[model samples]
Target: MIDQEDVAALLGTEGPFARELPNFAPRAAQQSMARAVQHAITERETLIAEAGTGTGKTFAYLVPALLSGERVIVSTGTKALQDQLYFRDLPRVRSVLDARLKMALLKGRSNYLCLYRLDQTVREGATFDRTQASQLATIRTWSARTRRGDRAELAEVPEESPLWPRVTSTPENCLGVECPFYDDCHVIKARREAQEADLVVVNHHLLFADLALKQEGFGEILPGASAFILDEAHQIPELAGQFFSQSISARQLTDLAQDSLSECNGVTGAIGLVLEPVEAMQDAVRRLRLAMDALPERGPFHQLEAKREIGDALHDLREVLAALTDVLASQAERSRGFANAHERAALISERLDRIAERDSERDVRWYELFPRGFALHATPLDLAAPLRAMREQTQAAWIYTSATLSVSSSFDHFARQLGLEDPQTLQVESPFDYAKQALCYLPSGLPDPSARDYTDRVIEAVLPVLHASHGRAFLLFTSHRALRRAAELLQERVPWPLFVQGSAPRHRLLEEFRHSGHGVLLGAASFWEGVDVAGEALSVVVIDKLPFASPDDPVLQARLEALEQSGINPFMGWQVPSAVIALKQGAGRLIRDVHDRGVLVLCDPRLTTKGYGRLFLNSLPAMPRTKELANVQAFFDDEVSAPA
Candidate 1:
């Protein structure tokens, strides 16, 4: 085994960042984190670590992971972070360490190009607007010359444009090995590289997806990996909830019907029997869509029973799907493409039946309406058992690291959520001097967060802090409703350039904020974590309220119900702790580096008035705090005579 100190020296002041880059400072915290990671891998045990921001955590784990002789899988929370690890950070690590490790990046299948889908779309072109037509023309040019065929490489096309998904393929739409362009498949090539590399970088969604697939008795995608490291591990419980559940949407059924209509338009014999039922299925879908449109908003699946038209439509759709399945079974001599499509159809039909029948006991059924269409879903109430099974299935050293994984100085909440018991745990504090460099202002005398005027009061309260900071702040809200209200209020109040989240793409908004260097960014959930903005540009993070999951959300309700059945206090056991972790994540946005200075302004009155408020405050890093607006101004001004 490599000595931790010897390897730790490589990341010290005189090491990689110092020798290769001009402005690099090595701290003892980063070295300590790297040592912990190294020991976890070497000893073959599970470890949970909370390394605060500016610990250079990316290198803390990557340096040990690359140096360890065993193959490692580094999973991240977001694709942007994955790209950063693979493109930017890894090269810098290689510059100093002599580790000749081969690295590969594998994204979810949707990110790669499917030649068959592109060809099919072109050969059977549909009506397109001017923008869609231009976007396809650009994709066509790129397809002819690009090697990787990754969707992210198309910088010209807007991420939200509908043209991209039309050209790409989903698992249901993919023709698999029967594709004519199987020889040049980008997904297959990426997977092959992943199989051969010493280190593989993947996002958490794909990581759990592969785990879920492996449990179904498939061969492992990561066969020889001995160390499995997760960055932003706080997101695992929610993602794992999504992974462990089963779902089938109305759009999925509609897409199948449309595809069969295209395929069976000119065919004859028993195979063509699919066309009639497929058409009926399309009408049933139309009925379902119309019935849902009559409703005021989305509700649980049971609520659909009140609308007799929806149940009638489901019955019609189910009957047609059964007929379609029977016809496909009769055609035993069908081509490989037909066989694959039949398997997909049969599975989808069965799920639609289960969700429609509402035959869920341990699971929960819910529905939501989107602009495109509506989707009915059945998700498991508990994922802990499945996650524990995954740990047992893989004999690897598992290390979970994030800046905010613990609540009130305990990892019990995090561990229990994932069925992880008594794992080795470490909490490495941020090297930033929060005592001298930052201030946490929790104002008093605000209405209850549930009050109708809570958002209005919050705006009135944070205006002073924003004024003091000179518009270099992020007004992070818990919901879109609050975000809009705050953005509307702040736009008129502040003079500095204001950049709201939806005004541009996330990357563009951050860049514009940096360029303005004195702009206020109002963002919701996505900005709570995985965002890195250092220096004096972002000097404050104003959280409008405590970060807690909405009680009305289907997934959270299901989990809470399950806890109640097990005789546990869901509020104290789940809600408060979960809120604590989320609050820590939001607060972490401030004081990103040692040189950075900022104040965290939490306007929620509950932090001081409510009993559970102590838990949230205890989770934050220790900093000088105050309730007075004068002290807030002084913190920014560096005044010695400021009130304590």
Candidate 2:
């Protein structure tokens, strides 16, 4: 293993950044990270680590990954991190290491332009408006000089533009080797680079998709990697479930119908020939919509008795898809121009077939009708089998690291979920003085999270903390409905500026909150993790509940039912540990740095009322705990007065 002193000396000599660089020298935690990577490379054993926020973990892993002289794939939880690694961190490290290592950043195919589709669109000359025509011309000009063909370069293209599908290929729409522009396909080009690169940066979804062979072109990732490093590994279990599942949306069918109509009219002058299938799909969508419309607006899906009607519509839709597939397949080889269109139709039909196949026990299938349209989802109750298969096939040192992997300092919960047995694990606590830096306040008398006054009580409990912290706070909720309600109530009651999740994109909301420096940001799910706001811009984290998955949630219900049939205690087996991990993630948003100070106010009162509550407390940082609201106010007041 490389000596820390020696590595530090080499880093200093590398001169990637000037002496006056703003970042601090790599700290002790970073050194530990380096040693761990070196050990993993030398001894091919799976390792789990918990590196805290201030650890400078990116460089800690990257330095050794670059130095090891072996192929490596680093997977992150979010696209933001992917961009940071590919655009910023990798270049700096490569410059400093002076190693001629080939590095490639591969995102999901959606991020790349589909050359074949773009060519077809250009030829058809379809335009929504004069402005859209101008945009298409601009895109055509940009495509000529784009070496990587990444769509991210076209900053002006709105994601919702109808032209996107015409310019980009889905897995179903891709022609693979048969594509006329296969050699120039941006996704293919990116994969070719990944295949040859020493280091590959990818997001968890892409990595899982590759591992599951769900991706169109690639069969797997990490074929040559000596090690696979997963950052934000806590998200893997859920992401694995998603990747291993199948989903077909009504909007997708409708879009296919619309696209087919447009292509037939624009390209082949055969709109009449395509009208039957298009109208069939439209009629199926209308019947499903009408069935859903008869049901109550909001309730558990199981409560609605319209399942039989919805099932009939689904069956009818499947037949329509089959007919469309036959029509397209019959004409696919007839013309070069319609080949992509035909392939798309075939793909949609196959997906519909997958949805149509009825499985009694292995998968949980459901339909959800949102405001826009309905979607059919089929999810495996357990992803353990596929995840284990990937683990075995890779045959490399795997390290899954994150701030919130353990519950009550035990890896048993997460390990069992991922189907890893007796894996070597380490729980490195954050080295900050949490007792002095933060407080965990649990208000006493709030109703259970399901009650009508739950959101109101939570808002009331957090108002004092927000005022004490002077609006630099995060109001994190587990449910979107609860979050919106809290945000509304708080907006009316609190004097500070308020930022809600749906008002803007998450990154934009964070930017606004940080810039305002006098607002309380309310968000759910994503905001609880992968968010980093240091200093006084964020001081208080108010959690509305214990962050438990609802018992009625279809996925959770399915998993729990499975556990019950297997003679396992569903609450202990699944709910308690998961909520503990989630609560820790919510609490973690506070005190991100050694100098950072803040308070975590959990208003659920379950922490005091339930026996499992103690487990949640044990999983949290060893911060000073108080049940009194006045103490929290005083701590915030003192910290504000004495600081800086």
Top candidate (lDDT): 1
- Could you give the C-alpha RMSD of every candidate to the true structure, in order shown? 2.8, 3.3
**Quick one: best TM-score, which candidate?**
1
lDDT per residue as tens, model 2, 1-644: 35545554444533343343456464666666667766776576777787766666787778878887778899999887898889998888777667798999999988888888788788777656987887788788989999887776777775556677678877766777978888778887788889999999999988888877833445564455888989999999889878877777777778777766665654464666678877987888787777777654434334333478866766787788778767666656655435666766776677667756755477877666687677666788887776787788777878888888888888888988898877878766676889899888888888877798888887887777777888999988888998888877876687788899988878778989999988889999889998989988998888888887866567778889899999999999889999888888888899888889888888877788888888988888888888898998899778858947
Give the TM-score comparing model 2 with the true structure, all chains together.
0.91
lDDT per residue for candidate 1 within 148-215, as digits (tens), equals 88888998987788777777777777777878888899988898999999999999999998999888
How displaced is residue 218 in candidate 1, in Å?
4.0
Error of 1 at 253 (Å): 1.5
Cα lDDT listed for each candidate: 0.84, 0.78
Task: Kindly give the number of clashing pairs for every candidate.
Answer: 0, 0
Candidate 1 has its poorest 10 consecutive residues by lDDT at: 263-272
